[model samples]
Each structure stands twice: as C-alpha cells, then as structure tokens.
Target: MATLLHQITIDAPASRIWEMLTSRLGLQAWWDGTVSIAGGDCWRLSSDDLESPVTLKVVEEEPDKSLEWLCVQGDPDWENTLVLWTLEKAKRGFTIRLEHRDWRLSEIDLAAENTRWGERLMKLRLQCHHNDDLPVNDDDLSVWT
Candidate 1:
C-alpha cells in the first residue's frame, strides 16, 4: 500500500476552494474532464486520458474544512482507493493538503500517478486564482497524452 501526498497554498478562501472541490461546475472548471452527478453523493468523472469513467463516492465532507472520496469503480487499480482534501486557513490564503491513499503498489506506477495528481492540483490552484486562460484541456506538462 502507498499514499500520495501533495500540498499547495492557494490565494483564496476556504469556502471558494470548497466549492471548487465539491461542485460539478467548479470541478469541470479545473479538472481535465467532464464531471457529472452519479446521484447520492457520487460523481462520475470521465476524461479522454482515462479508459473509463471513475465513480467517486463522497465518504466525508466538512464545509470549508475537508472532503474525502472513495473510488468505487473504474480502473481496478483505483478501486477502493481514497482521495482526500484538507483545507486550512493561512495568513495569506488557504493551504490545501491532498492525499490519494490505499493504492496497490504492484498495480500502479507511482511516479506517473504522482505527476498526474500534481498537475491536477496545479489546475485547482490556478482555477481558484480565477486564471482566465485555464488549461482545462491543455496538457502543458504533456503528461495526459
């Protein structure tokens, strides 16, 4: 088992960041994919880079504090994994801590996954900053080809 952790400091309020993490519209703004509601606190995330849609079940949520999801479907390597986001108020903005855990080591390429997550988090940060020229589908890092 392995856990991927990353952190970023965004110049935004926790409420705004929380919306970006919890809302479908907000997600589509930053996420490099289409986001749709799967009903009952579940979301379906689909991207050209992904073989299939990932179904994420909201396991825990605390407004402006934290949000956690469990991957219930999609890639076998992703199933049963947890994606968590924790937000803390900072002197200038908010600090976001992300953890993607419970990965089966043998089934995944940790380096690739880490890079992907890092890119996604960077998009999240850019979105929170209201960057008009967001690379929603642009793979500047050339990692999602």
Candidate 2:
C-alpha cells in the first residue's frame, strides 16, 4: 500500500475550514467537480475530469479537527482508498494536512496523483482566503478544464 501526503497552512479559522470540508456548498466552491450528497454520510462527486462519479463515504468526522472518507466507488485504483484531512490551529490560521492512503502501488501513477492533490489543496487555500479577485494562471486553470 502507498500513501501520499500534502500539507498547507492557510490564514483562516478552523471552523471555516471545517465547514469547507463538511458542507457540500463549501466543497463545491473549492473542489473541481459537481458535489452532491448521495445519501447518508456519502457524497457523490462528478466532474468532466473524472471517468465516472466517485462516491466517498464519511467514516470519521471530528468537528474543526479532522475528517476521513473511504472511497467506496470510483476507479478501480481508487477503490478502498482512504482520504483523510486533519486541521491544526495555527497562530495566524490553520495548517491543513491531507493524506490519500491505502493505494495499490502497481495501480496508480503516484506522481500525477500527488500533483493533483497538491493543486486541489492550493485551490482550497485560495477559496478560504476569499481570493475571487486574484488571477489564476492559465497553467492552473488547465488542470481542471
């Protein structure tokens, strides 16, 4: 099994970051997809970038602290994987750490997956900062388009 980790510090409240992680609307603002509650503690994420919708089941949630989701449906490589997000309060804001774990080493392009997660975290940082006025470079836009 393989694990990919990324961390970013954003100058925002933990409560706000927690909301972004837990709410569909807040997720849509940063995540590159159309997010909707599938049912119960599951979320269905669909995007043109994805071959199919990925269904994530919330396995653990600690308000303003951490959240974990298990990939119940999606690409074969992603199935059974775990996505974990942990937030720690910092002096100016919060440090968010993400772990995408339990991957089959033979099934994935580790470098690409790592880059994708890193970019998404940057998007989350920008969203939390309310940087709607800030310009996103073409290279960044190309990733989601």
Candidate 3:
C-alpha cells in the first residue's frame, strides 16, 4: 500500500477551516458536485456529471485539530482508503496537512491522484481565502478518469 500526502497553508483559522470540513454546504463549495450528510457521521457525495455515489464515513474527528474518513464505498479504486486532514497553527494562519493512504493502484494512477489532491487542496484554500466557491479548472491533470 502506498500513501499520498499534501500540505498547504491557508489564511484562515483552524476553527473556520474545521467548519468547512464538517459541514455539507461548505463541502459543496470545494468538493465536486453535491454533498449531503447521510447521518451518523456519514456523507453521501455525488456529482451530477458523474455516476458513482461516494460513501465517506467519518472514522475520527478532533474538532479543529483533525478529521479522518474511510471510504467505505464508491469507486473501486478508492474503496478502503483513508483520508485525513490535520490542521495546525502556522505563522500566517493554519497549515492543512492531507493524507491519502492505502493506495493499491498503478504508479501512473498514483501520480494522477496526487495531482488531483493538489488541485482539490488549492480549491479549498481559495474558498477559505477569497471566498471563491468555484471548482479548480486544471485542464492538464484530470482526476475524473
């Protein structure tokens, strides 16, 4: 199994970022397509442009400190993977450390996934910084394969 990691510093407090991470509306702002809370710390993420219903279960949460999820169902390539977000105070605001672990895919797919996360994290930062909700438009790297 392989692990993919990404780190970004956003100009926002940890608490504020935490809200974006836990709330449905906040998720929709940064995530692709619609996000709905499916009860009991579970989330149903579906995109109109896409067909799969990604099921994410909150396995662990620590308020403004950390959030972890296990992909219980959805894309076969992503199933059983662990997604974690760790936030800490930085010189300016807060640093978001992201991790995607338990990758069982080809190296090419792994690289694409890394690029995808980089784009997603940038979108999250933009949403927090300039209040921009639009998705990141990176034509060169596509995560929707």
- Best-matching candidate per lDDT: 1
Residue pairs with clashing backbones, model 3: none
Model 1 Cα lDDT, one tens digit per residue, 28-139: 8778989887775788888876678899999888788988999999977788999999999888899999999998855458877888889999999988988443334421
Report backbone clashes per prediction: 0, 0, 0
TM per model?
Answer: 0.86, 0.85, 0.84
Candidate 2 deviant stretches above 4 angstroms: 105-108, 131-145
Question: What is the C-alpha lDDT profile of model 3 across 1-145, one tens digit per residue?
Answer: 9999999999987766876787765676688778876666778787643347778899888888998999898877778999999999999999999999999989998998898789879988887885544344342111111
The digit string of per-residue lDDT tens for model 2 on 53-100 reads: 899999888788988999999867688999999999887899999999
Report residue 27 deviation for candidate 3 (angstroms). 0.7
Determine which window of 10 residues in candidate 2 has minimal summed lDDT: 136-145
Colliding residue pairs in candidate 1: none
Which candidate number would show the highest TM-score if scored against the true structure? 1
Candidate 1 regions exceeding 4 Å error are 106-108, 131-145
RMSD of every prediction: 7.3, 7.6, 8.0
Candidate number that wins on TM-score, 1 or 3? 1
Ordered from best to worst lDDT, the candidate numbers read 1, 2, 3
What's the residue-level lDDT of 76 in candidate 3? Answer: 76
